[model samples]
Target: MITKPQFKSNDYKNGLYLVATPIGNLKDISFRSLEVLAKSDYILCEDTRVSKNLLEKYQIKSKLISNHKFNEKKNTLQIIEYLKSGKLISLISDAGTPSISDPGLVLVNECIRNNLNIFSIPGPSAVTTAVAASGFSDKFLFYGFLPEKKNQIEDEIKKLSNFNHCLVFFSSSKKLNKLIPAFKKFFTGRKIVFCRELSKLYEEYIRKNIDELELFNNELKGELTIVISEKKEEKASQKLSESDINLIKRMINKLTTKEITDLICTNKNIPKKVVYNFCLKLKNEI
Candidate 1:
């Protein structure tokens, strides 16, 4: 059995502590997380009631302050003053790591610029957990959240489809119906994994072809992180013939095959191996 970290007495010395909390499962909370919350002079959280539940569960009695997106600007200054006065402050979100798809980046950046010490007690992160279990490439782009508008989402997906890296983004179950259709339109023929309720008892990873993701989206629940595989480039670009390759080579004969590969690999469109193979096949035939 794994032992949780004990909330150390002196961990929150000064400055800000960004604590990672469990998304759903209380057991997901880390040892240092409990420690930071216990020792901090004040806790700045997204939702007081939500944070209260976690704190009360652990029996932590620190003061709680609301610091969400709408009021973060004002609260940040207040937090800075507290830090300046040598008070220990902790920033936590309702679930998962702070400032990810949630809120916290602005304050964290401000704290860093002002030379305040910032410590992160890492624990459960939906982004990392989803990516780790995705079975996709290790390399990925964490998009955090998708655009709210349909056209904007299509444009973004089209732009990202050019890359070979797996892309991850957070979405809500309410938006899953619309989002899955847009994904199918812009990113067809790619593999996608929809991770829901990560680390919870009902945690699930539904892997499907982008074309088929719609059916699975019907019964989806809880918060979601969608991981879409980069579009298949060679299949998209395979129409280019030996003649096209020759034309490109002739246009830039002075460039090396590696250089040519780099140029054609624009946006991770084609697999490097495919590009290199095309260069070799064309070079020998020419």
Candidate 2:
């Protein structure tokens, strides 16, 4: 809750500043972020060239150092030594906030362990920016990036579908085509918002049902954030009653243990593990 006393660049000094840059539109940056960058002794960036473009645009002159994932571990010590000399330092990612699905966590953690002061100059974040304009409840869950494996993705989406709030995640344009179908399978009738190139001139929020979104042609492009509305409320998952078990047995009679387990799980809308373990106990009794 510390407040900057003034908007002057020289006002900031001698500590680690975690500055938030624009996710898309460069103008989305805050005054404080600019001041911190301008005043810092040097800036640690995911890419020095990318940070240089932003600095040149703003007419701010500061030393630049590359601190991406590959070099972050080794560079952290050097940055800390600079800070130990009472030099003001700032960290920025290519886009959005640092350490949020981006590079910055290691150096920040090191700074924390070294007992150095770290301050945040808030600006744009694709997750919150998309969520704010999503027309969905604020209680939504944010999964920074979708799982890469198809089975893992499906399971994760299925778990999120059971929740009662919106879900947000980042995906490449390549994965978007594959993701929509899975969303339809799990969430069915829910609405989705595909926020592309947010805050930039080409920014667009394409709202459609997951089923309908699946019909969109391939070659969709841009950095994408997919927001899916929660499914209609259903009864919570709990142990099934005897009546429920009887209904499942009717559908799976004389079926193998695997078949019985699957039918019982679908009937009770519970996790397969729970149903499988229960079916194992029933087999032991017989």
Candidate 3:
């Protein structure tokens, strides 16, 4: 059966509304998101200057409140009071969904503590956009931004390397260039995609193997969404046979343990660790 979708006017409730704005293109916003913003008594945003462009484009006249990381905590109490007063308030980031690597969580939590109503106006997301286009595994982990310190960044990458699912990260071009070395060192044998200026006119997707990635000589502008493909699973090691054991026993005394392990692994499709362990066991028994 064929059916036509019907549009209905929005009847907003007085509470906090987490609205999602376009990441790049102004027209990428949903109609429902606009309706919610239009009906909102006040819109809390990370940056009023950035949100202004979007509002002005849609001819939306909703008042905006500046709420960023620095001031979000201080603004939470006042905002909660507004929600308690039965005022319809909306929260939006400079781009993408609110509270996603942006301001809005503190206010949302305050609203929850106050038992206030909250609504979600989902729309665009750089994470999903990059992952979808990267041709990587859909299962992903979005680590918003890498730490500033080099050691912290390495530690973070080391932890993330243990996961088998695709990994997504947000970084500026300069920072991304600095991160390429770390990515190559930790994420070897994996594929990577760099999504630049996503959804914008100069949008670009650079795909490369981790080993082939090199630093950009020219400084690229705008934020980058990096998606690394899942770790490649290793082939199972074959069990050592009686003939293989005898060969290792014969070579254990004549050749060094490392040489024997290397020779056995190179001759057969076996894991180096497995061969190394057997050689170490025989040497220990001697």
Q: Pick the candidate with the highest TM-score.
A: 3
Q: What is the TM-score of each predicted model, taking all chains together?
A: 0.78, 0.76, 0.83
In candidate 3, what are the lDDT values of residues 1-286, reduced to their tens digit?
3122233545777889899899999889988898888888899988889999988887788899999999999999888888888899999998898898888888888888889999998899999999999998989999999998888888999999999999999998878776888898899999999899888999999999999889889988988889999998887566887888899998888998889888888757788788888988887888
Mark the 10 consecutive residues where model 1 has the least summed lDDT.
Answer: 2-11
Q: What lDDT is reached at residue 249 by model 2?
A: 57
| Candidate 1 RMSD computed on C-alpha atoms after optimal superposition onto the true structure | 6.4
Candidates 2 and 3, the one with greater lDDT: 3
Clashes of 3: 0
Q: Work out candidate 3's RMSD over C-alphas.
A: 6.3
**What TM-score does prediction 2 earn?**
0.76
Alpha-carbon RMSD to native, per candidate: 6.4, 8.1, 6.3
**Model 1: residues with Cα > 4 Å off, grouped in runs:** 1-11, 215-219, 232-286
Task: Report the C-alpha lDDT of model 1 over 89-143, residue by residue, as the tens digit.
Answer: 8999999889887779999999888999898889888888888898888788888
**Predicted candidate 2 versus true structure: per-residue lDDT over 152-196, tens digit per residue:** 989988888778888989988887777776888888878889999
Worst 10 residues of 3 by lDDT: 1-10
Model 1 clash tally?
2
Q: Any residue pairs clashing in model 1, and if so which? A: 5-31, 7-35
Sum up the clashes in candidate 2.
0
